[model samples]
Target: MEFQGARNFSIESPGNDVFSSKYDDDGHVKRTGTWVTASAHIVTAVIGSGVLSLAWAVAQLGWIVGPTILTVFSAITLVTSFMLSDCYRYPDPVHGSRNPRYMEMVKNVLGGIQCQLCGWAQYIILFGTSIGYTITASISMVAIKRSNCFHKHGHEAKCHAANYPFMIIFAVVEILISQIPDFHELSGLSILAAIMSFGYATIGVGLSIAKIAEGGNHATSLTGVIVGEDVTSQQKLWNTFQAIGNIAFAYGFSMVIVEIQASYLSYPILYYSTQDTLKSSPPENQAMKKATATGISITTLFYMLCGLLGYEAFGNKAPGNFLTGFGFYEPYWLVDIGNVFIVIHLVGAYQVFSQPIFTLVEGWCAKRWPESNFMAKEYHVRIPLVGTYRVNAFRVIWRTLYVILTSVVAILLPFFNSIVGLLGAVSFWPLTVYFPTEMYLVRAKVPKFSVIWIGVKLLSGFCLIVTLVAAAGSIEGIITDLKTYDPFN
Candidate 1:
């Protein structure tokens, strides 16, 4: 019930007496809590905005090949998730704490240079998450304005593209909600968005299918787009890299998920203490494996609905968020109704942006000020007001600096495109392609491999390939786009 002599509250699995999992053989769930409960869904959250490009990615690659890569990549990552759990876990008493704990162990396994590299990768990933969430918030706002959701609610909506005020408003609102730092508020926002999204998509997608039955183009389902007018090897190469990069990123996040296994080791007690754990449970831990993947089931269905119905009803003009593409699929009247939820989700997206930094930074602060309890952590402290504020203030300043630095690098990136920018410019290499594999190797105490480990080695090699290609392609695309924009040549 206690970890490292710290009696704290976190999500714990149901007692081994009632329900248990093969992955969670121990009586208590490991390292489990609210974080673990939310971990699985975090992928969708991480991949949330990027899903907009799914069709484009598929269009670039062969139709069947697109999902094949995803499936294979997902399977490999699924195995790697379990593999990561094994590598990082101590079957006996001590558990590798979550990502940070795993990082520490990996340092010991790989030695100084590699450990530092791994640390940097994690650092970027942590911040990369912030960037992706921020971009999603920005993009969602634009999508909302384009939707009838704004008009129906009768909100003053206008062009948000290049509008600095809208961006600032969102950023400020996000900062406030983030200040709350309670699971209740954040999860409430996430759940509302999730439900509206999943719910609407299901209904719309069904209607779409019915429309198709009433003689729509069946070829949309069984269709392919041959983009890249010239069809050069470089374009093919770029497409391949993007696909691989997507796979590796998916796998990378999955590796992060196993730590959720250890995290939940303490969940039951934490939730029980609060009374009616089910009442407090969130999607990933509570709804995923425990409820037979219910949360993701809901999510996947929603996504399909959005993709299919949006595609079918709105055609190519499908708006990517909050039924913004209502005009694409149906009348603007739907957009009118959707306006309410759109605001709700802009708030949600803002929460997503604020949360990662708040939680991650607060964790750092807690360690620095270990002398203080929760009350002190929340409000004031005896440790010199300026000093306490300075420590906290420095974190905010540093994180902002890092965010700015990341944006600078992203802009500098040759491929201004999100996927390429992410993979090449800043985020991908450190988190997905590098950390998990190296951490696993480090934990294994060898720079070598077993037969099964050979599989990991090959997979890591593929990841490296994807990483290089993605980065290169992104850089190339950025240059091409820039040159085209001005045409100095």
Candidate 2:
């Protein structure tokens, strides 16, 4: 189904006063949604399980360095997001020349195998990052319960699995639920997404604040809490650098090629609704710049708030839990009450991740399912997701399945070292630092540092290195502990 030919719908665009771009019978944009509630898309995409690590690092780096990362990122994002806002700048699609997308943009600017390879590489990282998050969220869920349960029962078989049931149930439920089609419009998912993000931040803030306010009792000594005090000076220096890097990485200013297109009068609808919005958006500097700017602002706000609050509560010698993190310390209760919300959050994340492919699927579906009732407004409403999905559903289905399976892995994997390593190296480094810039580089020919793209990559690299080293140290100690002590296994 080629959705490209379908008449452009006006309801989904960000420029809509109400934020709901739904069109009317005459194809007029809907004026209904007046932004009643704040959204979490900004929060969800930016802040995740990485907050704990970021929070800890913030404390180590002090209020200055930590906040600096966040503030700098926010400033950069503000520019990027506004530029993204300008993607609508071309007097709207109803007026004139539309923008091109990642492939098109890169093809236009830096055509060749490199951009193509980058396109493919970025798809992997973006989808992989999504998978990693799903895995981490699931793992945290089970681990939190198990950690608490084990502390009491001593790792008995009854509760040995740690959220095993939730994993099975959650994945199946999400799968079935996802099949139900949109709960109406993209905004619905946006709401769900916002909650998950807010929930994560809320919990972390609550825990950190509780611990910090309590003072002393919840605070763990730096050396003691981190676990390896007497490592070589190089390692120690490296660890400190890692902490700084995490801060920098969290400063998420990137040259986003995707959001820019959204602001463009001619950006493909798939860009906003696709499985890979970043990669799928128009690639021109105007488009890319706009996307990066939007990403920078929304993401920066989320990261900065999370960092500030997380640091407040968890920073500097503090050990506490966040909402999602709470599921780690107190699972059943947290899951029982928050799971519904958490489920929403996961769905939100899934939808956002699925967009890259979904948009493509939607695009294909449109081509395949040519509008029988062109005048029918529903055609406009459904076309994007279907079009993109049709183009990429097979991939989406597998990635979705992969996400679920990996989440299940989270339930089973429990080595502190592995967790830290994954959290730091696998999760934090890539998404925060590596992914943004590397992905953007596909279209970013000259790669200017002044651009958020440069900042994101530079910062991500800085963070990735530090996080990996710290994780490596922690993992090594765990290996040694297992060999010598063998506490339970």
Give lDDT for model 1: 0.44
Best by lDDT: 2
Tens-digit lDDT track for model 2 on 1-489? 112223763344454445423432334333231111111223334554445456555544456656665565455445433333333212242232233344443344335664565456445544544454454445455555655665567545356444446556556655644543332345555555556656755655555455456654344332322335434555445445455444433442222333221321123222431112222224223333443445455666556656566656543443322343443343345433443454556665555554565455555666776663332123112455454222234443544665576555444443322344333443344433343344345433435655765665666566556556755654554454456543223
Candidate 1 C-alpha lDDT tens digits along 409-463: 4333313143423443244445444555666655655446577568767887766
Indicate which candidate wins on TM-score: 1
RMSD per candidate (Å) reads: 8.9, 9.8
Q: Per-model C-alpha lDDT, please?
A: 0.44, 0.44
lDDT of 2 at 210: 55
lDDT of 1 at 320: 28
Model 2 TM-score on a 0 to 1 scale? 0.56
User: What is the TM-score of each predicted model, taking all chains together?
Assistant: 0.62, 0.56
